[model samples]
Target: MQTFTLNDGNKIPAIGFGTFQIPSDGSTYKAVSAALKLGYRHIDTAVAYFNEGEVGQAVRDSGIPRDEIWVTSKLWLQDYGEEPAKKAIDLSLKKLGLDYVDLYLIHQPYGDVPGAWRAMEAAKQAGKIKSIGVSNMTPKIWQQFVPQFDTLPSVNQVEFNPYFQQTALRQILAKNDVKLEAWAPLGQGNQDLFKEPILNGLAEKYNKNVGQIILRFENQEGIIVFPKSVHEARIKSNLDIFDFELTADEVAQIRTLDTGKGMHDPDAPGVGDMLLSGVRFDNVAQKDSQKSNR
Candidate 1:
């Protein structure tokens, strides 16, 4: 697996197994176990995913050395305050059955981001996390948010794909030396993307599927991509992107598909409220909160 060096000097695998919508009913564990067996060293999960424990269990059972794998989780908006964020970190660690995560991110741009980031910075200093970053932040939000902190974010994971390429955001992130991680890199499996002439042409030229061609395009752009799937064949094929390379012109051809806009707006009305209302602190975190109230 190819690795990208973060601004913080930590190396992260370019391709990972994303566990966002994977159900926790033992399916997450089975899928994760299969991913590990298939040679995926990086795993991305979040507190909001409600499957961190299952992911942890899979990792423990994989028999892979703990350090050989990279585990990433996020701090939800409900745990945005410094103290709550600290407790949330501990809770995530306890559930993961690990001392520290490879990466911890501010899951969204809302809430007390500074306070949460301060907690993350302290965690990095204390060796509780190897790196820290944010997700779904727009270029405007990033410009304002980054200046308020002493520590730079190692990455900005956003919704990026061939159609919505985020050119302005990439330029800013590049200028700040922050790596861009693509969350919905396959456009949420949109079939229209599969029919694109540019991507189709490239897929034919490379003798790979449209999905692989798209992933390879992002990989060549130095963007970290983690396409999620519970199916074993798709999971296995997702990692088989390192064998080929696209020439500069061919890469530019892929770039022509950019629409300069993403499907979801992070700043849309009710987005923050909707996300906040869905907060579900695990039993461990809830107990910690109750104790603190005593």
Candidate 2:
């Protein structure tokens, strides 16, 4: 299995199983179980996803040894303060039914980041989290956050793909030796993106699908990815990119597809206001509970 060595000397699988927006009502469990069975060594979830329980349940039930899987979770904006962040980390561990997470990330750039960083650093020292990082951080946001910690973030999870390559942000990560993990790495299965001649041509040449072309590009660029999929075939196919390499011309061709479109503009005016309002998983959890009781 291909893995990236984090600055802290920890290794993370190059491709991870993402559990974003996966439902807890057995869908997350089934997806996770399929991922494990298909040889995925890394699993990612977040407090904001509200499916950590299901993800964890699948991992434990897979009969896979705990040490073999790299589990990652994130802290929500609601758990930004020092004490709350600390408590939230513990709560996440409890939800995942794990003693420690391979990597823990701050879900967004807003909130009491300093307090949260301090808490995360403490957790790292205490061995509760193997490594820590920030997600959805722009070049400017990351520069601001890096100075607050004694060490730099081990990973920076970003919305990276052919559409929004974030080359500038990637330069910063390279300089700081931080691993870049691409979330929504395949452009969320956007048909327009998949249909691009550059990707399609590469897909035809490589005898792989557009998604595989995109994933191979990321792997060749040394970026980590956690592509989300509820389908078992897609999950297995996503992990099958390790056998090929993209040529320089092909990589440059894909790079031209970057239009800088991402899920949100980190530098947009008053962006923090919108990010602070982030995903509300409570209502989703409540609805799931109601269904379970029925």
Candidate 3:
């Protein structure tokens, strides 16, 4: 697997297996274990996904050296304060059954981000997290929020794809030496993307699928990508992108498909409220009780 050197001097795999929206009912363990077995050395997970425990178990049992596999998890918005962030980091480590993570990110831009970042910095200093960064951060948020800290984030994971290229934010992140990591790198399975003639033509030319073309495009652009899948064939295919290389003209052809629109806009009105309603430390027990009552 190719690795990208982070601003913090740490290396992260160019392609990782994403675990967003992957349920914890043995599915996560199965998928992650399969990914590891198929030569995926990088795994991305989060507390918000509620599958950290399974992801941890898969890595622990994969028989691969822990240091050789790069594992990343994020801190949730509910755990945003300094003290709460401390506990949240510890909880993630506990759930992951690992002493530390390769990368730890602030999952969302809402809440007391400064406090959470401070706690993350302390954790990094204490050897609990190797590299720390943010997710879903827009250019405005990145400008205002990141300058307050001395340690620039090693990477910023966000929504990046052909349709929503995040051109402006990428420039800002580049100026600061923060690498870009794509979450919905496949455009969240948008049908239009798969139907695009450019991608289809490239797919045919390279003897790869549309997904592989997109992943290779991003990989050539110096961006890290995490493409998610639970199906065995898809999991194996997603990682089969390192062999082919896209030409400069071919990459430019795909760049023409950028629509400058994203599926989720962090700057949209009421997004903060919607995010806050997702999960919280104070409401976990109540939510569990409600789930059981159902």
Candidate 4:
């Protein structure tokens, strides 16, 4: 797998298997186990996803060396204080049945963000996490948060795709030497993204599907992409982009598809409150929360 170098000198695979919205039933474990077996070394999950334990189960069952697989989980908004966020890290490790994860992120930009990030930096220093970063913290939020923290974020994950490319944010991240991870690189099943003429033409030229073309664009742009799917065929197909390359002209043409917009802009008014209000988790993480309080 191709890799991106983080500011902290660690390397992350360019492509990963995203486990968001994977059902909490046994399916999550089974799909994750299948993903590992199907050549995916990186698995992205979160406390909010309510499936870290399942992800750990799959990793253990696969018999892959712990170092061979990269597991990532996030700090939910509700767990954003320094002390609670520190507890959250230990809690996530216990749930994953691992000593450390390859990455841990502040999932959203709301709540005690600086406190949450301080906890993450401490974890990184203590070796509980190999790298730390933020998610959905768009440029506007980056301006507000980066100045407050001493450690630079290793990455900033956001909604990235052909139709809603973040041109300005990419430049900012580039200047700061932070990696960009794309959560919905295939545009989260938006039919319009798949129907774009430029993407379709690239797909035909490369003899790959539209999804491959889109994901390949991310590879060329040096962005990490975590596209999710339970289908065995799709899982393997998503990783088959190293053999081909997109020309500068072709890449530029795709860049033009950018409308300079995406969902969940942290700068937008009311987005923070909206996200904070909407976050809900009632599985093991929440049960553990009650125990902590008691």
Task: Report the number of the highest-TM-score candidate.
Answer: 3
Cα deviation of 3 in candidate 3 (Å)?
0.1
Query: In candidate 1, what are the lDDT values of residues 1-294, reduced to their tens digit?
Result: 679999988889999999999987788898999999999999999988878888888898899999989999998898898999998898888777788999999998887899999999999999999999999999878876778887999999999999999998989988879999999999998899989988888788878999999999999998999899999999999999888999999999989888887889986899977888874666755553343223
User: Where in model 3 is the C-alpha error above 4 Å?
Assistant: 281-294
Q: List per-prediction Cα lDDT, in the order shown.
A: 0.89, 0.87, 0.90, 0.87
State the lDDT of candidate 4 residue by residue for 31-96, as single tens digits: 888888888899999998888888887888898899888888898887888998998898888778
RMSD of each: 3.4, 2.6, 3.2, 2.8
Candidate 2 segments exceeding 4 Å error:
277-294
Candidate 4 ranges with C-alpha deviation above 4 Å: 278-283, 286-294
Ranking 1 against 2 by lDDT, winner: 1
Of the two candidates 2 and 4, the one with more favorable lDDT, higher being better, is 2
TM-score of each: 0.94, 0.94, 0.95, 0.94
Candidate 2 lDDT, 1-294, residue by residue in tens = 888899999999999999998878799999999999999999999888888878778888999999999999999887798998998888787777778999999888887998998999999999999999999899898878778877689999988988999989988889879999999998887888988998888889889998999999989999999899998999999999977899898888888889977876877888788767766555564554344334
**Once model 4 is optimally superposed onto the true structure by TM-score, how far is the C-alpha of residue 20 displaced, in angstroms?**
0.7
Clashing pairs in 3: none
- TM-score between candidate 1 and the true structure: 0.94
Clashing pairs in 4: none
Q: Model 2, 239: alpha-carbon shift in Å?
A: 0.9
Q: Which residue pairs in candidate 2 collide?
A: none
For model 1, the superposed segments whose C-alpha errors exceed 4 Å read 277-279, 282-294
Pairs with steric clashes in candidate 1: none
